[model samples]
Target: MTDALSPAARLALDEAFERDAARGGFAHRGAVAVIGDDALAAAARERFGSPIRLFHELTPIPVAPPEGCERHGLVPELVDGVTLVVGELPRTLAGVDEIAGLVARHADADVLVVLAAREKNLERGMNERPRDSFLEVAASRGRDKARALIASGPRPTPSPAYPRSEIVSGLDFPIAAHGAVFAGTRLDIGTRALLEVLPAQLDAAALPERPTVVDLGCGTGVLAVWTARHLPGARVIATDRSWSAVSSASRTAQLAGVADRVDTVHADAGEGIPDRSVDVVLLNPPFHDGRAVIDDMAHPLFRAAGRMLRPGGTLLTVYNSHLKHRGALERSVGPTSQVARTPKFTVTRSIAR
Candidate 1:
């Protein structure tokens, strides 16, 4: 069956399966296993010839196991002896840290991490971070710059360092963040600048009762939390595509004591949000997709905001100064007006037409 895959994919599958088999593969395995990456999950299915359980989100949620298997979530507490496989390393340091923290949580499990050679530093970090939770860690010889890190011998459970919460002196409430969440429980310069200027522009008192607000890429829900608390009558929706981001934002809302006012949803650019329903949309749009720095990533988000916002509603955004998203904002959302600009970032307010 694997022969049908592209040559590169076949090679990847062959190498990974061969190494896994040499380590005494899943055959007769007593442990429950979880695969992180989708492509790797496919390869694992071919190798194991069984339906492997997939934890699609960064933070594991409850999933009914395949028939005859126990239910599993981020941690399969009921299952003794677990196997964790990370097929690909994430692109960002935060993402890498998140994966490391997740692997650490299952300290009692056997862990195997397969990373591409294209990222030398990531492979090195993958090998090192496991040592923090596992008592013994070993590395396999490299093949095609792809290698595996094998770890076992669980240590006494260490306090979880991911999903960390911290208080920033100026902010009204604390931020709870997962490792993969942007800014790591701290406000980034751009977000800070935007927040500084937002109150004056939003003028919550002037807004209609129960004003609907959307935080389009609500990383850790800082903007949403602040809005929900300050506006009092506002109904805030915080949305981000990353599972880790959604989980972190949800936690941030709770810690801010505005969970009733702020709702967190996992989505790609406000997909399910109804058109012309929101009174305001706050954005700290990303300039990159994966490793590629591109200005186009914000375009769709702008369009989505334009669609979701009511006539005369506002879209407040902060972005890297150099990207010059003003023109894009004007074109996608409505007329754009600059709110504030730091040397590194620009805050703008766009009104829906």
Candidate 2:
């Protein structure tokens, strides 16, 4: 289970399983789970035996399924109406014309498909790299299904918009971030919302006798030092995915003269920290993934906090009001509530128990 998956992927597995299982009945009509067709069928068969007729169809593609593993192919006898609009998927984004052209001329079926893998790799998906079906998980996961999950990896990473040269301003930021050079200028709204209310929400007990604050996904370390200066005894750990962001945050920390107090590290978004040892986790989380429309990369932040927060520790984050995630925030984050809000942004205070 701790295979190639990131912490985010590892954590999302159970929810995926429950979603997949609920889609297919324990025995009745066959339900196709595209992610791991072979595993599901074997499990289903083992549990049901021959008394229940579950037809499992695996697509002939070689890649693993999106939500599960694939062996050989899926059986046509398992489901009754597939909802995955393959052409609507990101894997088909480039060749959408061809994909849509095919789907436009396609027929309907009664099958359930659960696909988690996408046959496209980073290269093919980007069009710069040649297509190698052998290595492309997106191209193959359970393909031939009436209704099943299609293998599309977690949201594709958007190409960095700012160039290396364009990130020049960050060089001046004192001590600097992990790789340095990112989000250094004016505070972004997400970061701003966090700045406006995070301190007031945190009390003396929230921190340890010697507090440690992680400015998670800390683009440019604005909050890292801010927390250090305001909290006095608190040590701040600033981090981000972009090397540039790390560089800049480090500089900011040095400029603040809290260089030793605040440590900036290069990390995979929220993957940098040790699990479950933090006092307060503050984030002005990313709201957009480049030009594409994604509000937040909540899966990682939520899962990472779940693993990192000491029992009863808290995760304080800011979000735009329009994207309202109060419900999702409450569900993923134990006992969550809104701490601050403006017409544009809302600060969420969640305790991780």
- Model-by-model lDDT, in order? 0.70, 0.49
lDDT for each residue of candidate 2 in 1-353, tens digit (9 for 90 to 100): 23443222222233334444566733443332322223434443343232222222112233343333233211222212332221112222222222222222221232222223232322234332112111122222233221122222211232221212222322233333221233435556677667666657786335677877788877767788778877888777887765446656766776777788888776665664777778888876666653345765665676676677777888897877887777766666678887877898888888887
In model 1, the clashing pairs are none
After superposition, candidate 2 runs with Cα above 4 Å error: 1-183
Maximum-lDDT candidate: 1
Model 1 C-alpha RMSD to native: 3.8
> Tens digit of lDDT per residue, candidate 1, span 7-97?
3334445555666688787676543344344454555565766546555554234434444333233333522344545344454555555
**Candidate with maximal TM-score:** 1
What would the TM-score be for candidate 1 when compared with the true structure? 0.85
Cα displacement (angstroms), candidate 1, residue 50, comes to 3.9
Per-candidate Cα RMSD to the true structure, in Å, reads 3.8, 15.4
TM-score versus the correct structure, for each prediction = 0.85, 0.49
